[model samples]
Target chain A: MLTPLFEAVRPIPAIALVPVAILLFPADEQGIVFITFAAAFFPIMVSTRHAVRALPTLWEDAVRTLGGGRRHVLWHVVLPGILPGVFGGLSVGMGVSWICVISAEMISGELGVGYRTWMSYTIVDYPAVIVGMLTIGLLGWLTSAAVELAGRRVTRWLPRAEEAS
Target chain B: MTLGITLESLSLGYARGPVLNGIDLTIRPGEVLVIVGASGSGKSTLLRALAGLLPAHGGRALAGDEEITGASRERAMVFQDDGLLPWRTVRRNVELPLRLRGLPRGERKAVAREWLARVGLEGHEDRLPRELSGGMRQRVQLARALAGAPRAVLMDEPFGALDAQTRAGMQALLLDVLRDTRATVVFVTHDVDEALLLADRVVVLGHGGIRTIVDVPGPRDPAADRTALRAQILEEL
Candidate 1:
């Protein structure tokens, strides 16, 4: 859903929430973590649901006729069928969490990439802010790309996104 | 132990309307009844109704003396589409009916392998349905339907999709198996030749219902002179 797209880019949006969090949560790290968790939850849940709904009826019928009950079918068939979708959602959620964590730190309180970036900004040290942003970008990309790779390996049955396109 | 079918004004169809209207028919022990009709004429629907796969719109069906309105576990069906689960191996496909019946795993495996061998798929037990050829899949379906030792076997054009040569071979195999099992068979097909070759009595079903149940002469043989009989049935149609 729209949640995944927004959460994946949450770090960029977290900068904007700095003023509001500072007013609401008394300048603390707890508020920053709270914001980060909020940014990742929705996307993961929605994508997993979509994947679960898209499985073929033939799979269920085949299992049932082959002597599998409802529980066996759900776990063995439905779970594996939707694992790729769940991984996709999870990757988005993780990327967003890292982004929001850094942004929350730099703008609202002490700690995280956002906090250090803001400190550098106050001292007019453009290099430090640039370094923080570059570090966050590189780390986020590596983590998300790792997730995508793992997803592909797990779902070798699914066609590659580029090839399918 | 004789297999018999009794239907009292059985009506069958989907949500829209009845595919086969209220009609009475009986399949006696060791008898093969071929229900012939054109496509969409509810030939398959009638077969499915007999198998208890499709619910009746009206009336009832009894296998031997037990009613088929509920789960009878006495009837097995081979769908026209070969309804083999793509994920299952040939052996497992044959074992499915037994598994559904709640037999132990060891017994299921032994019986499944026995039936798979009977269908000439002994070495291909582990091969998935997708890996098998069309004829092979159809044979697997037959093995699955017959493995449970059902009282009646309903086949909806089991060989309808196969090549001519393969279809003929499958028909011969089926006749051989039927002779051994003596299971009451309700074979639905559009081919007059197939109906004539396999059925003890060929029922030519036109647009409305079964027009006539023609008592075929002598034991059916495809190589025999059935041309005159075919023409006679066509005239009746």
Candidate 2:
């Protein structure tokens, strides 16, 4: 909702939001931080809810029979059960946040890879913009990959694809 | 033994549906009681009521002076399937109840190993439930129930799913475990041979309540004395 409104004005793309951010909040780096947070929040929320809902009833009953109180069951059994889903959500959210931050800087106001990319574009410096994009892609890929790896490690109880083979 | 169970006007069913109606029964401590019934006659419901897993919706279950309105740690249940945690190794699964009870690590592992060894699962501790044969997983479930050190164990068709030979072996193994531990056991099964093999008293559930709770004076060896006892329980069924 907020993104389309921010994007309506023409000369600046969303990416330019970073550079002018310093002057708007000169004492603290609040604006850029808030923008990054907004980009990653929703996907993480939805994925985690999906993970929690998918846990088997038997697992929950087993925990209860073992004398786990509500809190213990939620933290130890429920949380671990849904971790892969939550991590998947977080990874997607984080990757999108980084990708859009660069794009936001390029299109909108001031500092960040996006702003630098747009500046290069204005000067007809295509290679610099390409470099900005490659950097964003690499960072996003690495972070998402790291999250997926962590999820696999945590859900080691599940049957692995190799083992099934 | 001082422990005994009684249910007074115990009526149990789902929110609206009926399973048991105005039922009353008594089980002596260290006694092996088997409940037999037709399909959906509530033999399993009786076990659940006995274990305190079933709410009255209408009736009351009492273990001596204590009321069992919900599941209690003092009783453990073994279902038809091995209810082993797929994620944990056999040893870890057995150790779970102890860990939940706040038992220290060294002691919990030691107790877990002893119970595993007793159930003939000594070397299979590190193996996950899926890696083991069905019989082995059932033994692990048995070990888990025993490891909790419950005063009574509730079994709902514990060996009903196994093949004939495996079922016989599991029956023998279960009797050995029960005899060794002397825990009061409430077993629910439609299998007459199984009931004759393990139970000291066979309680048939029909006509809404305990049709009969018969005492069988036979040798503990099911494989040995089963010919006569099996016929008797079959007649009762």
Instruction: Report the number of the highest-DockQ candidate.
Output: 2
Give the TM-score of candidate 2 (chain A): 0.75
Q: Which residue pairs of candidate 1 clash?
A: A105-A114, A105-A115, A106-A114, A106-A115
Instruction: Compute fnat per model.
Output: 0.17, 0.40
TM-score of 2: 0.85
Compared with the true structure, what per-residue lDDT tens digits does model 1 show for residues A32-54?
87777676766677788899899
TM-score of chain A of each: 0.77, 0.75
The Cα error of candidate 2 at residue A150, in Å, is: 0.5
- DockQ versus reference, model 1: 0.21
Tens digits of lDDT, candidate 1, B168-199: 98998998888888888889998889989998
